[model samples]
Target: MKNLICLTMLFAICQRTVGQQVELPKATFAMHTGFLFGVWGNYEARLGQRTVFLTEAGFSFQSMAVFTNEGKEDVITPVLLVGPRRYFKSKISKKKSGSARITRGFLGAHIKFKPNSFFLDSDGLYGYANHLGVFPNIGMKKTMGERFVMELALGVGYAHYFAKQEGWPENIDRPTVDLRIRFGFNL
Candidate 1:
């Protein structure tokens, strides 16, 4: 009788443990490669089951090409991005494996700050330009294996320039576009 009771308790505990759902990752660290900022480190934290808050800080090696006329200049500028992203459930299914690839679509409204681009002007004057912008973006994040993740995003928005150089306009109606690809691992 004692052996039967022991076996039953062991079976019940094993069933309970095996039946629990897998928990989602709560934090991730990523790397970004894109148009404006060449390479950056990103951190994202889950705020809810389908929402995450992200922040990134990095250097832009191509800031001169985007902001100034010095296309061949090697300039490095500071870049910062902050935003909250909401993920939508995906409906895609797979027939071969009987399990779908985990892909989540996300929408985000991000604020970007690029400060202090030092460039030599056409008139031999050194100047600095600052950019502040808002971008509404749409993206898809795909999770692979246990910790690997990849994301792609596109955005179009407006940028306001603050310049301290002659012939450089402080235009607030400038249009900007962004495309980003990121690879990450859950931490």
Candidate 2:
């Protein structure tokens, strides 16, 4: 059933990509940290001058604390930050021997999903929570130092968790802050 859902979504994405007849530049790949946690990478193809089809994947190892004891778990995450990437147009030139670095900033929205993991408390009781959510994220990309280019983005979203058989509270508190940040370089 899960495979079916994933295939359906994949088909939808393929349809969108094939439907567009615009000729654009090749895809760009990037690796970054701060996407939820750990390291993540993305493949972005320019669908238009200000539009991008961004696909990202990463993993996060985290420990969560509820009203009970903390549980350590591993989660897999994939995100698509596909939307209009707002940037300034026109170009500037310098008369120096070397050209100056160009920096651009953008704000966009994305939809994301994370796989669940086993959560074991101190009492040996365990449960799992899988979340699917969306958030509005903003980021900037520019040259730093002489050769490094970096991008950072942060987003906030509300997630609902479904747990298995455990006396987990009926009204559990949500995370005080559900934010995702990614710092990576354009490749």
Candidate 3:
């Protein structure tokens, strides 16, 4: 009787351990290659089944070659962003038919950086231009599998350029748009 009881207890413990092994979702990292827009790739990490941490770094290159205006040169500006995200899983159906699970939801608040660019006048003289600004962002994501995910986020914020710069219209301010994407493992 003593041996039977010990064996039964060990079996129960093993069963519990096996039950605790939950498979985690996959993660993703992606780049933005849109027209007139150049962005670096974004990285994300899944934590505790429903939350993610994100980081991104890159630069924007705006072409001014077509412009008949005095400032005709390409601009290279650095970009950096970081933030936390949360997701909600969708309910599953009771039907016996095999089907893939889908997850979708909103995410908010990551820090960002946008630097200013300088331009030259028609006479080929360089002049100081608008300064960069920092912005906070909010966004969303959609997943097709337990291991793969994709996200789209939009950020809005204010910016300030130097008032002393030449040709900078008075009372002008900085406002920017941030767009991002992610593709990688979910775990």
Best by TM-score: 1
Winner on TM-score between 1 and 2 is 1
Compute the lDDT of residue 161 as modeled in candidate 2. Answer: 50
Model 2 per-residue lDDT tens digits across residues 1-187 = 6534653454444334322132323667777777446677777777656457677776554555433354443433333333334332212334366754445555454556555444344455443555555545555565543334566556554455544323455533243233555456767
Of 1 and 2, the candidate ranking higher by lDDT: 1
Worst 10 residues of 3 by lDDT: 14-23
Worst 10 residues of 2 by lDDT: 16-25
Tens digits of per-residue lDDT, candidate 1, 52-121, equal: 8989988666534444575445566678999887665453435575644567766777899976654443
On a 0 to 1 TM-score scale, where does candidate 3 land against the true structure?
A: 0.49
By TM-score, is 1 or 3 better? 1
For model 2, the stretches where C-alpha displacement exceeds 4 angstroms are: 1-25, 35-37, 61-63, 66-100, 117-127, 144-147, 164-182
lDDT of 3: 0.52
Candidate 2's TM-score: 0.57
Model 3 C-alpha lDDT per residue in residues 54-146, reported as the tens digit of each score: 787776665433123544576555667776655433433232455444545444455665434434334453434445454444455545444
Tell me the RMSD of model 3 versus the true structure. 15.1
Q: After superposition, how far is residue 15 of candidate 3 from its true place, in Å?
A: 32
